[model samples]
Target: MNSEEEFFDAETGLESDDSCEVSFKDATQENGVWERRKKLPAEMISRNNFSVWNILKKCIGMELSKIAMPVVFNEPLSFLQRISEYMEHTHLIHKACSLSDSIDRMQVVAAFAVSAVASQWERTGKPFNPLLGETYELTREDEGYRLISEQVSHHPPISAFHAESLKKEFEFHGSIYPKLKFWGKSVEAEPKGTMTLELLKHKEAYTWTNPMCCVHNIILGKLWIEQYGTVEIVNHRTGDKCVLNFKPCGMFGKELHKVEGHIQDKSKKKRRVMYGKWTECMYSVDPKVYEAYKKSEKKSGGESKKLRQERSCEAEEADEMPEVQETVTVIPGSALLWRITSRPAHSAQMYNFTSFAITLNELEPGMERLLSPTDCRLRPDIRAMESGDIDLASSEKERLEEKQRAARRERSKDEEEWSTRWFQMGTNPHTGAEDWLYTGGYFDRNFTDCPNIY
Candidate 1:
């Protein structure tokens, strides 16, 4: 099938059932990979050129910000929803929580944190700025996890999110404040914030901060993004921490996506070393005592040929396929050496997104009853964009924006301040900053008025 068929199925519509899940692989099947399509419109390309040239002339030695860019350079999702991108590898987190070793859990958490930056690999298109009080929630029944995010502030643009996994006894909450800068040729977004994760079973709490985001090749070449800086994950309970340094791309294309870090004990003694590419997999390896471990399987070579018929009869009795074969390799060794699976390469890119990028803003299948009236899922314009109706999306976006402006004007007349429904204000002990905490009893507290079985 072609690209059009890969994105939409004529029989089942956009929402594919299990039988007809849309695959974005090339039809020829020679190379099973995701086919890249043109991401920008011709008009937008020309508009970007003009905008870049004008900005370069005006800001000769100054840094630029979001105010310098045109709205056309934006994706259809809101920034508040973008925070959910961290959940793409929830399977890893679940597996980690199930493990018994603390070091094993730390490795998995490190992998999850590093892999979260992979979503920014392609072009750096801005997501829409969420209006004040806009909310989004994600519920994964199979994973036994739920997450809720809200936009708390509009002027300085703050967002907060909370996620919990009751089965794993894991809970996390955090806030993000993206500080954007424009340097004529590229833009930098520093997501300054702190996240706290709790393992209730272990009574352990971990905190970490994000790295700096840089978008390059915006002026004269193909645009792409890179994240540079250090990510430090610290266990407040045990004083163990992991520090990862994301190396920036060099000038002549050297070591573009390389990252190396080490896990340290309370006294800063190195324990396990990590090395990998952000776009690929991260591995924990200790080179000081490096040894390869491989498992072997043995089959009886003296078995009689007549016994094959008997085995087939037994297989038939068990409803097993005679032609199919199963091979299990169990390699039991040190748990430090393992790879974190990156996003699937064959997965389709909607508007030049990584495979897991769109999953962040995905609406739960039956969450309509649990959503508030101001939820992002109810926004008609964004929904239009999701369905590939660009014209309708643009019109609806303009209409909604104008309506928002009118509402703001009315609020100004009444001297009213926008208030969030689910989140309450609290102080962050680490930073002493007023933070928004989720008080909606989203996970444990009863929702007596909720019509949905959430």
Candidate 2:
């Protein structure tokens, strides 16, 4: 058999034996948005170069074509309908709900992403559509009521894939190899999440109405792992340091990073050394600790001799008989697993987002205390200078305001462009509900009638 035959059995149009039922739920919130006003320092104000609303344009929903940077589509309804019909797991929902309530440092980071996105809408009258609708409390915003769309689109528990991705990225980013392993997507494993955060002493802790844990540079994914998932972070530095407190999204743990202590000057140059150095060091695990972690995989057959013998023989024969191996391979797909692509419905650059970047911003006395003298905060905010200090500050301030107005204008233009495309699809907001009014990044830049996952 060839790749076509093994991965896609076009002849039978049959799906794999391993499949799960998916469902969606509206998060248990009335409006799926937080109600509040953010107050910035009188002198220093911060604005976004990129709107959080834009992140929605990029990631409003998931699509099958997202696998390729440039995607192709076939069987529109069959494809998306299948994507919507993910596996139904009560345990997953429970865990998701549980995780969404975590208040850990990592959880705060996720919340900040939501808050940041929501802020953009409030600031610019744009919309913040959510994959999962959740709320801090009862409140309404100017744009409209945000919905959590608790429609849990279930697929295979992607923890192993996620962990593997993280491991690979961590090694690459840290330049140190740990015991990285990518667990194949597993059916038996329940997908759940928790958070652990170690705030370096020098990093700024933004004190909002609710203190939030700010994580810079990385895409802060859903808090508590898609509402009920697992994220483990082992702090090899600070034995016990809790630097943040915020609204509960789920349960979390705390530890400090090892690089914080070696700093002499609390300057950007010094912090840079620590951040770049230790994150690369591979934290070792004790033999006992490593063994205990294998419990999750213990049930998949307990490493039986018979299984090993069969696997060894199969490998031996595979070298000599390629066709036999091909015949034995399982085709992985679903009758529902088709693809969807489209012309550019949104702005060209706004449609496809590589990922969401979130950071906490402090209002007053901004950078003065953001990087504490004792804290070894990495990546201290770099303020670009335009001229001599005073003249530069005044000119830059005016320039920032002008850029903001221009951004608002650009957003309006993008909306108009998208609206033209939406009308082309014959979708009417005022019209009564229709059967399949699925519009997302899929029809936008996601598919672009090209590859996916760019």
Candidate 3:
């Protein structure tokens, strides 16, 4: 089942890696990655004519069911209004398949080609893609964000590093990122650089990767937070706005990701006493205690045992405590920008991104939009050994061979199943008669007894 133990022809695959990039400007073809852009009738808009803004307006009532939102929206556009818009863009995606002209197909397909080029627009608004169940929340801080940082010791968790490196590789070789208007103005800059392999040996891979969408990173003094934090709104998950009064603390909960503030805790409730962390983490500490430690550290002398005991019980550890987070309000425009990718390479293997660009003037009144979201951040991961390939060990090579054999067998079995059905059943009444038999019927009807059928 897990063929990771098998050896991969890294050199052959990486060195001879035939990868191409296209853009809305120029496109080429692959195994149907891009199809012709059909000449639609007078009243309709081609998918290309739809900008990010117009598309969002279109998804208002379309039923997504269980689609992968992140893959479709490369970045998170979390707002309901935006989600509805993007959905409309996809409504006509089937048009690409309908076209018959080569140029039209190229134009359609070219829209999907990645040109070592990237564009970034930094806005602190929840940019969510319903297609992919990934979200980005921009907040002042992400204290218990799974992990804030890591070190590379003897064999450190190279987890975050790999994904970051992939992003760098793409930036080095990809397209020029332009500045976003609302994000500010752009300064002159150099075009992106080219990437080439250079280094090393044994490789360890993980089946799971970073979340479908990237979360925003927090800095102590930065004015805007990108992906996760607290915010105001109807809890999209449960639809509760935290307006009901419960026990003391009058029904409080966490903040909305991307937007800042506890979406549930309103300033109007009957002066409810609130203290503690937003999450009911088993080992959560009170924020009061956390502050006490800082206070104690600044004191002139050593702490007494009684004082130490008191310090341990302080509620500084929990931020939700009314004392620490006094202004429980969200200053909108602080959410992550999740972009939508029209067509995904593989439905299951989808990629979505949340991005931000850090600069001195970004949050300033007269902002500089120079650092586009793609420039400041993008989760493009291209993995290949710098030296081209790693040699496979004997066991690994054998394992690879075994895996290939198993795959071949499975494919053959599928072919056999299809072949058997072809000879047993017959054709369609809707279309002209054909030789192929439709196998879908056997599962539902008793064909042996039915006298009248299509």
* Per-model TM values vs. the true structure: 0.72, 0.17, 0.16
Q: Which candidate achieves the best lDDT against the true structure? A: 1
Better of 1 and 3 by lDDT: 1
Task: Please give, for residues 305-412, the per-residue lDDT of candidate 1 as tens digits.
Answer: 665444451221222212222221222322433333333454334555544454444443444455555667677766666666666767777776667667778889
What RMSD, rounded to one decimal, does every model reach? Answer: 15.7, 25.9, 26.5
Model 1 gets an lDDT of: 0.61
Q: Write candidate 3's Cα lDDT for 177-223 as tens digits.
A: 11111211111112111111111111111010000111121111112
Q: Which runs of model 1 end up more than 4 angstroms from their true locations?
A: 1-71, 287-349, 359-369, 429-434, 442-454
- Clashing residue pairs in candidate 1 are 64-182
Cα error, candidate 3, residue 440 (Å): 35
Query: In terms of TM-score, how similar is model 2 to the real structure?
Result: 0.17
Off by over 4 Å in 3: 1-50, 56-58, 61-283, 286-454
Error of 1 at 390 (Å): 3.2
Superposed by TM-score, candidate 1 places the C-alpha of residue 148 at a distance from the truth, in angstroms, of 0.6
